[model samples]
Target chain A: MARAAVKAQAAEPLDGAERILQILSESARLFATTGYDGTSMRDIAEACGISKSLLYHHFKDKDEIYARITLGSTRELYQFVFDRLPEGARPIERIRGFMVATGEYFQRYRWAWVASTTAFWNDPEQRRQKERMMWRDRYENLLRGLIQAAIEAGELRPLDVPLAGRLILSSLNWMHRWYKPEKGMSAPQIADAYFDMILNGLKVEG
Target chain B: MARAAVKAQAAEPLDGAERILQILSESARLFATTGYDGTSMRDIAEACGISKSLLYHHFKDKDEIYARITLGSTRELYQFVFDRLPEGARPIERIRGFMVATGEYFQRYRWAWVASTTAFWNDPEQRRQKERMMWRDRYENLLRGLIQAAIEAGELRPLDVPLAGRLILSSLNWMHRWYKPEKGMSAPQIADAYFDMILNGLKVEG
Candidate 1:
C-alpha cells in the first residue's frame, strides 16, 4: 500500500499525454495477460500506479481505454505501413514494405498488439465498433490492394485476391500467438523468412 | 424457466457418453462466444439444459470442462490427422494430408478449435497444463518433422524448418478469426488454395 502510494505520487506529475501513454501501455500488458474480462478499472489503476479517480479522469471506463488502445494502435499500424511504401514502387516492394513495417510495429508494441487481438468488441459500442472495423478493414485492404497490383503488374500470378490477402495477413497476425521478443528469431528476421518462402516456393528450382 | 426445464428433461434421457458430448458441445460454444471468464458453470448448465448438480457430476468445474474440451479435442485432432496420413507417405503428401485433415476437423469442431486457442492456461493446474502442452507440441512436431523430411528428400529447398511449420499453421489457424462456414469459401478449399500458394511462388514464373 505504501509503495503504491509512493508510485501514485510519482505518477501525478507527468504530463497528460505521457500519463495516458503509460496507462495504455500498462493496461495493455495486463489485458494481454489476464484477458479483458479478468481485467478491471481498479486493476488498471493499480497497474498504472495511479489512483482510481486519476485513472477515471483520463478515461471513463475499461471499454473506452480498450477501444482507444486497439483503434489508436491499429491506426498507427496502418499509417506506419502506408508511409513506408514509396510511390511508384513495384507491388512486390510494397508487400515487402508492409511485412517489415508490421514486424517492427508489432515488436515495439507487442503488448498492445496482443491485447488488440483479444479485446472483446461485443458490446453495443457501435460507434467505436464501426471505427475499429474501419481501421481493421483499411489495414487488410492495404495488403489486398498491393496483391491485386502485383497480379496486374505480372509480378504475381493471377489468384484469388482475398485468399492471398488472408494468407499474408495470417502469417503476420498470428505472430502474436508465438513470437516472443526475447526468444528465438527477431520479428523482422521471421518476416523476411516468410517473405522468402512466399516469394520462392519451397520446392527445388529444378 | 419452463423451456429450460423441458430442455433439461430431454437431456436427462441420454446415455452417459451422449450426455457428456452434449455438455462439451454446449460448453465449447459458450466458452467460444462469451469467453472463459465471461462464462459460468451456471451458464453452461443453462446452455446445456442440464441442472447445475448434473453438470457438476460430469465435470468438477469450469477449468475441467475447458481442459476436457481443449485437450480432448486436440487429442482427437492428432489422431484424425495421424490416421489420415499413411506410414510410408512421401513428405509432400504428409504435408497435404495434415492440411486437409486440419481443415476438416476445424470445420467439424469450430467452437472447440476457437476455444482451445483462447483458453487461459495460466493457473497452476500443472498436470493438465503439462498434458495440454504435450499434445500441442506433438501436434506442432508432426508438421515440423514433415518439413524436415521434405527437405531431406530433395523435394523442397532447405529452409528454417520451424518457421516453415509456423507459416503453414498460421495460415490454417487464423481461419478461426474470419472464415465462416456460411460464408465465401470452404475450409478445405482455403487450405488447398494456401497449399498451392506455398507450393508455387506467388510470382509469375519466368
Candidate 2:
C-alpha cells in the first residue's frame, strides 16, 4: 500500500496508552447512559471494539474501570479549573473564573463528568471510595476557600461558606440533567449567567 | 393473649395498604443505598421481614416497586408543596414557601426522595418513565411559573425563567448529597438560607 493510503486506513492501530484512553472514553459514555451497575466488562469491551480478555488485561473488573474513570476525571477537572483561575485576581473574580472554567471542562468532557458524578459509591470498594471522597473534599474545599476569602475581603457578606459553596456547585453540577450544547447557551455562558444571577441577586433594587 | 399484650407484640398484623406502604418504604431504603440495579426483590423482602412470595404478590418485580415508590413519592411531594404555599402570598414568598415545604418533605421522607430522584431511568419500562417525566415537568413548571410571576410583578428583574428556576431547584435537589437532620441545620432552615442567598446575592452593597 502507498504510505498515504496506509496512513488513511480506518483500522490504524492505537498505541497502548491511546487504546487505554479510547477504552476509558467509550466506557464513560456507556457508564453515563447505562450507569455503573448497569454496565458490564463485556459491554465495555464491545463498546471499545476490544476483546473482553484484552480489557481484563488492563483492568481487573468493572469496579476498577469505574474507579479509574471517576478518580481520573475528577482529578483532571480539579486541575483544569485550577490552572485557568488567575492567581492575583480579586476573590470574586477568582470565584467567577472557577465556575466558568469548571463549566468549560464539564462541557468538553460531558460523558466523563456525568459518569464521575453519578458513579455508584456504595459498592464494596471501600478503599476506592475513600480515595474518591478525598478528591471530593478537595474539590469542595477549593470553592469553600474562595468563598471564605471573599467573605473576609468584604466583597461578600458574612455567610455560611460551605452552604455558599454548595449553592454554586449545585448549579454547575445539575447542568448534566438539562444542558445541551446545541440547544442555546454554551456551558461557560450558562455559568456566567448563573454567576451574574448569584452576584446581583434577583430582587429589584429599591 | 390480652388485646393490649397482643398489640404490643412486634409482629402485629398489618392491613394490606399498610403492608404495601411498609414494603415500599423498606424498598426505598434499599434502593437509596444499593441503587436500583443493585437492589433485588429478595433483598427488599428480607429488609421488610416478609417472604419473597409475599413481596412478589404485592408487586410484579423490583421495577414495579421502584415505579410505585418514585411516582407515589413525587406526587406526594408536589401536593405537599402546593398545599403549604399561601394562595395570596407574593411570588417571592410563594417561592420561599415552596422551597421550605420541599425541604420539610425531603427531610421527612429522605429515603423515598433519594430513591425517587436516583431511580434508574434507563430501565425498559417506558410507561413508568413517561409518568415520571410528566411529574418532573409539572414540578419544574410550578417553579418556573412562580419565577415568571415574580418578574412581571417587579419583585424580580427580568431573567431567564427556566434558568432561574433551575438555579433554585439545583440547590434544593442537590441537598440529598450532604444534608443530614442531626448534623446542624434542618432542611427548611437550609432552604431558607439558600433562598436568602439567592435573593440578596453575595456581593456587598456599594
Candidate 3:
C-alpha cells in the first residue's frame, strides 16, 4: 500500500500539469468569450472533462493559470521580435520586419495577445505590477533601439524616443481588439496598410 | 395592504435603475482592475453597501448589466460623432475637429471605452455580434462621407472610402487600451501625433 501510494503521489503532478494546460486552454476560450469574471474554475474543469480538484492540483488558482497563459504569449512575442532582428539591416528595413513579425505573431496567437493586454488591466496587486513592468521594459527597450537607430540614420524626424515608442506601440497593440481573421483583410494586408500610413503622411504630396 | 404594495412596486423600478447604475459604476471599477469573470455580483453588491437581493432587484443578472453598460457607451459614442457634422466647414477643419472630439471622448470615458471594446472580443455570441454591426455601420457611413468630401474638394487621394475609414478609426479606437492620463501625454497631444502622421505622410519631400 505504501509503495503504491508513493507512486501515485509522483504521478499526480504530471497529471496535474496536463490537466492544468487543458483547463487553461478551455478557460482562455471561455474567458475570451465570456470575459474573465464571467468564467469559473468549474466551467474550466467541466470543459476539460475533469473535476475542480484535479484543476487545482495543477494551477493552485485562476490567476496562476491566467499568468501562465500570458507568460506563454509574452515569451513567444519576445522570441518572435528578438529572433528576427537582422544583423546590420537598415532602420527602415528593420522596422518593416518588426511590423511583419508582429502581424504574424498576432495571426497565430491572436486570442492570447488579446487576453494578455486587455486582461492585464484587470489583474490585482503583485501580479498586475509585475506584468506591467515586464511589458514596459520589453516594449520600451525594443522601441527605444529602433527609434535611436532611425534617428541616427536620419530616417525619422527628431522626437522623444520613448513617447514616440508609446504612440507606435499603442496603435499596433490596439489591432487585436478589432482584427477578425474572417474579415477579408489578412494579417499581412493590415500590416501593409499600417506600414504605408506610418511611412507616408496622409496629405497628398505635390 | 394592496394599495401600499402597488405604491411600493411602482417606486421600486425607479430606485432599481439608480441602484443598478451605482452597482455598474462599482463593477466597472472592479472589472477594470480584476476582469469581468474574476468579479462577482456578490462582490459588486458588497462593494456597494447593498444586499444581493437588492442588487438583483436592480439588475436581472450580470449579463444584463454588462449589456446595458455597452449599449450606453454606444449611444454616447454615436451622439458624440454625429452631433457635430459641419456641412459648411473645410474638409481639413472638419477632420481636425472630429479627431479632437474623439480624443476628448476617449479621455473622459476611458474605462467605459475599454470595457465595451474588451467585451466586443470576449463576448461574441450575445453582445459582440450586435456591437460589431453597430460599429461597422457607424464607421462606414462616417468615413464614406469624409472620404467622398475630401476627394471632391481635391484634398485626399482617391482611396477606398470604407477602407480609409477603417484604417483611421483603427488608429483612434486603439487609443483607450494604452492612453493613461497620468502618462504626461494628453489626448490632444496624442491625437496631434496621429493626425500629423495620417495627414502629412512620413516621407521627406525633396
Query: What TM-score would chain A of each candidate receive against the reference chain A?
Result: 0.73, 0.73, 0.67
Compared with the real two-chain complex, what DockQ does model 1 have?
0.56
Give the per-residue Cα lDDT of candidate 3 at B6: 28
lDDT of 2 at A10: 16
Model 2 chain B: which ten-residue window has the lowest total lDDT?
B1-10
Give the per-residue lDDT of model 2 (tens digit) for B1-206. 22222224316677785567567767787776687789988888777667899889999988778778867777767777888888999999999998999888787666677777763434466776687778888888998999899999999999999999999999999998888666788889999999999988988875
Q: DockQ for model 3?
A: 0.32
Q: Between candidates 1 and 3, name the one with more favorable TM-score.
A: 1
Q: Report how far residue B99 has shifted in candidate 2, in Å.
A: 0.6
Per-candidate Cα lDDT values, in order, are: 0.79, 0.79, 0.65
lDDT of 3 by residue, A17-112 (tens): 334434555666678888788988888777666678877877887888777776656655776677776668988677766776777767655656
Each prediction's DockQ against the real complex: 0.56, 0.56, 0.32
Rank ordering of all candidates by DockQ, starting from the highest = 2, 1, 3
For all predictions in the order shown, the interface RMSD in Å is: 1.5, 1.4, 2.7
Give the per-residue Cα lDDT of candidate 2 at B122.
Answer: 44
Per-candidate TM equals 0.77, 0.77, 0.65
lDDT tens digits, residues A57-114, model 2?
Answer: 9999887777777666767677778889889999999999999999987776666677
For B36-145, candidate 1 gives per-residue lDDT tens digits of 89999999888767789999999999988877886666776787677887578889878988998899777766666776776343435687677877888899999999
The candidate that achieves the highest DockQ relative to the unseen native structure: 2
Q: Which pairs of residues collide in model 2?
A: none
For each model in turn, which proportion of the native inter-chain contacts is also found?
Answer: 0.85, 0.81, 0.56
